[model samples]
Target: MQTVVQAAAWAQTLGLPRLEAQVLLLHALGRAPHDRAWLLAHSDDALDTAVQATFATNTQRRLNTEPVAYITGQKEFFGLTLHVDHRVLDPRADTETLVEWALSCLADTPSPEVVDLGTGSGAIALALKHSRPDAQVCAVDASADALSVASANAKRLALPVDFHHGSWLAPLNGCTFDAIVSNPPYVASDDAHLAALKHEPLSALASGVDGLDDIRTIVRQAAQHLKPNGWLLLEHGYDQSHAVQTLLGNQGFVNVQSRPDLAGILRCTGGQWPTVK
Candidate 1:
């Protein structure tokens, strides 16, 4: 039976990245990173067999280009550790920019009602709710499987959010909100990224040929769902900001603008619905 230190060293020798090696080692020992030393001191034959099995699975999946988050079924976003799988797109740091924008918009509004369209793993909705406990937050996804994952996350985090299984604004037909935010499928169908994105749900990543299909639909429809003076904020591809801004402009939204992510990429665009006359 190999000790935890020995197993970790072996995984590293397999050419796995340093962080991945640590994760695999922790999985092999059936312990978290902090517990690795404790498991090493109590190792036995049965534990060794379990460790070997886990290592094989982890190594094989990594070789297949599966994301470590999907492999571990977890991802961290907005300082929150979220449970995730292939059913939903893994939350990325770029999307945090949208959350920060939402928080800023909500700052002046009292008890704002926010809707997260196409919420996956409830990352946006949950993060918003966590920040503004008094705000009314609702999230909807077209995929039942994704909704399930999001619901589970909401429950685990004890964050209150309404989860619905339907496409776009279908579930909230008669409802209106003070703000609407989403990181919709902005990747074009012909995008080269899809080849590497095969491990994730296709429906959650790519849209129509131009990749603006869903974004277009959301832009046109969101105006109706938003209250007077409410805002519609969306995260799109870095290069798609111009197109998204155009879409928001044609929809008659005021104060239209795009914000850059930490990397200075135009990542989010938003506009305010005009107050009724």
Candidate 2:
């Protein structure tokens, strides 16, 4: 029988990061992902044969560059534990910046109306609703499959975000919001990094040749949907902030600015729709 410690070491030998190996091992053992301390206490405990088989399969999946969240079926985003799978893009920590910025905009506006475009996994929308319970949050997704994942997460978290299925702001045609936020597909279709992201839905990753296709659509449509003085915030690629800010400017948005991600890379940009134009 392989011991718990031995199994983790074996995973490391196969090139998984130490943290990933430990996380996958704990998952296979049916323990919480954060139960690393338990592993140390039970290092010598024999891993059941069934657990070992599960670990091996998940380890190979990780080796293929599949996101750990997909293998485990859950991801922690903005303090909410969301269920995820191949149907939706895994939520990343950087997206919290978008949520934070959105919250900041709505801080003084009681019961502000907000909408999230391309809300894969409902991470941004859910985070906003969870943080500002008085806010009316609506989320839109182009993919029915992505909506399935996002809505499921909302149900589980008991967050009552109005979910709509359609491209961008189309479903919210007659509605206007105090804020509209999106982390749309901004990866260039031919970017070299796309080769490493084969496991995620391509529609949720790549935009046009320049990666600004979705951002442009949002900036153009957002003007109609946002109330005067409303905010439009977006999370884009590491280097797309300037271009995104320009799009907002051309669309007559004001106060355009960018915010950095955890790594200090400018990852999010936003502007307020003019109160007068």
- lDDT per model vs. reference: 0.87, 0.94
Runs off by more than 4 Å, candidate 2: none
Top-lDDT structure, candidate number: 2
10 residues in a row with least lDDT, candidate 2: 193-202
TM-score to native of every candidate shown:
0.89, 0.99
Over 4 Å off, model 1: 1-6, 9-15, 33-47
> Against the correct fold, how does model 1 do in TM-score?
0.89
Count of clashes, each model: 0, 0
**Model 1 lDDT per residue over 102-164, tens place:** 999889999999999999889999999999999999999999999999999999999989998
Cα lDDT of model 2 by residue, 1-277, tens digit: 9999999999999999999999999999999999999999999999989999999999999999999999999999998899999989999999999999999998999999999999999999999999999999999999999999899999989999999999999999889999999999999999999988868999999999999999999999999998999999999999899999899999999999999999999999999999888
lDDT of 2 at 15: 97
Clashing pairs in 1: none
Q: Against the true structure, candidate 2 has what lDDT?
A: 0.94
**Cα RMSD (angstroms) for every candidate in the order listed:** 2.9, 0.7
